[model samples]
Target chain A: MITVTGTFTVKKNKIEEFQTGTLELQNASLNTDKGCIEYKFHQQQDAPENFFVYEIWDEMASLELHGASQHFNKFSKLLEGNLDKELDIRIYNTI
Target chain B: MITVTGTFTVKKNKIEEFQTGTLELQNASLNTDKGCIEYKFHQQQDAPENFFVYEIWDEMASLELHGASQHFNKFSKLLEGNLDKELDIRIYNTI
Candidate 1:
């Protein structure tokens, strides 16, 4: 299994849009993607604009497919110019 | 519930020591701590020295207790000077 953690800092004015878009992507992955083991979104309690995405995929191929899914692609596009900086992404494996 | 993500970059010579200490801490939390919902440790696939600790607590009190636990304190001492830098910790709440 592979785990991915993405850190995003949303623009002050686009918080609502970013949240809605991420909710859509998260729901699709959890509900329809068979390879998705866990797909969760979180917001920093002290810093509301900071968002984090934690995902687990059963295989590399599944993760690749997830990135290519229409919902994900759409959300990615929707997020353009809505972030404070480029997404800081990290991928991990069981120790 | 509160979630915490901790990023640690280990010293090159102490990888084995750090892993063993973390494994001990992880096992103790999962097996003995009643309020620990999730206690997972992961290593970045592309960066062997980078470690990530993902934790979920049932309440703020649980997290506080966790930090004061004997096992956790012991492990923390074991890690002294074994890290490349101070741990980068992030706390979050569900969106």
Candidate 2:
């Protein structure tokens, strides 16, 4: 399995907007992607603007497909200027 | 629930040792702690020396208690000098 973890920092006061868009993308990924095993989003408790996304895919190919999906494309467009920094992503494999 | 994400970098040539110790601690935490909801460990694919730990507890107090548990203390001692860097932890709440 391929696990992807993304740490994101949202623009000030934009958490609600960011979360809504993320939920839309997350739902689409879960429903439309055959290999998406898990998709979960989390918000930092101390710093509300920080977000984390944890995902599990069957393989690298499935993750690539998810990146190219329409919902993801839309989300990328929506998040263009709403982020505090570039996404910090780390890909992992179960040990 | 309280969610904690910790990023770790392990010393070279010590992943096997680290993983074994970690698995022991993880199992102990899961089986012995009533508040531990989930405990998962992941190894970075590109950087095999790096690790990520995802944990969920019933509340802040449970997390505190877990930290004080014997298994955790033993694991901490085992991890001393075995890690390339201090654990970078972030606390989050599901949104």
Candidate 3:
């Protein structure tokens, strides 16, 4: 299995938009995408603008597909100019 | 509940030692720590020296307890001089 972690810092004014976009993408991935073992969105307790995504996919191909999915693409556009920086992404395999 | 993500980079020659120490900590956290719902370690596939730890705790107090546990202290000692830098840790709550 592959694990994916994404760190995002949202613009203070764009929290609502970011949250909506993230939830849509997360929900679509889990309910519509295949091999999506787990997908969830989180917000830092001490830093409201800071967010994280923790996802588990059965394999790399599944993760690739998820990225190219329509919902994913739409969500990306919805987040334009809404973040402080490019999403800091990391991928890993169980040790 | 709380979610924690930790990023660690091992020294070039310390991979073996880091792995052994990390596994010991991971196992102890999952098997013995109270309110620890999940604990697992991962290695970045493209960067073998990079490691990630994913953990879930029932509450803030439970997580605090984990930081002071004997196993955690022992694991900390074992990791000294093995890491390239301080572990980068991020904690979050579900949104």
Given candidate 1, what's the lDDT at residue A57? 95
Q: Clashes per prediction? A: 0, 0, 0
> lDDT of all the models against the reference?
0.89, 0.89, 0.88
Per-residue lDDT, model 3, residue B61, is 90
Model 3 chain A: ten consecutive residues of lowest lDDT: A77-86
The candidate maximizing TM-score is: 1
- Candidate 2 per-residue lDDT over residues A1-95, each given as its tens digit: 98999988989878889889888988899999979999888999988899899999999999999899899899889778889988998999876
Residue pair clashes in candidate 1: none
Candidate by candidate, in order, the iRMS in Å equals: 0.9, 0.9, 1.0
The residue-by-residue lDDT of candidate 2 on B7-86, one tens digit each, is 88989899888888778888998999879998988889989889898899999999999989999999889778888888
**Residues A1-95 of candidate 1: C-alpha lDDT, one tens digit per residue:** 99999998999888888778889999999998869999999988888889999999999999889888998899889878888977998999877
Show where candidate 3 strays beyond 4 Å.
none
Instruction: Indicate the worst ten consecutive residues by lDDT in candidate 2 chain A.
Output: A13-22
Cα lDDT for residue A71, candidate 2: 92
- Structure candidate 2, residue pairs in collision: none
Writing each residue's lDDT as its tens digit, candidate 3 over A34-95 gives 99999989988888799899899999999999989999999888667888867888988887
Over 4 Å off, model 2: none
TM-score of each: 0.96, 0.95, 0.96
Give the TM-score (vs. native) of candidate 2: 0.95
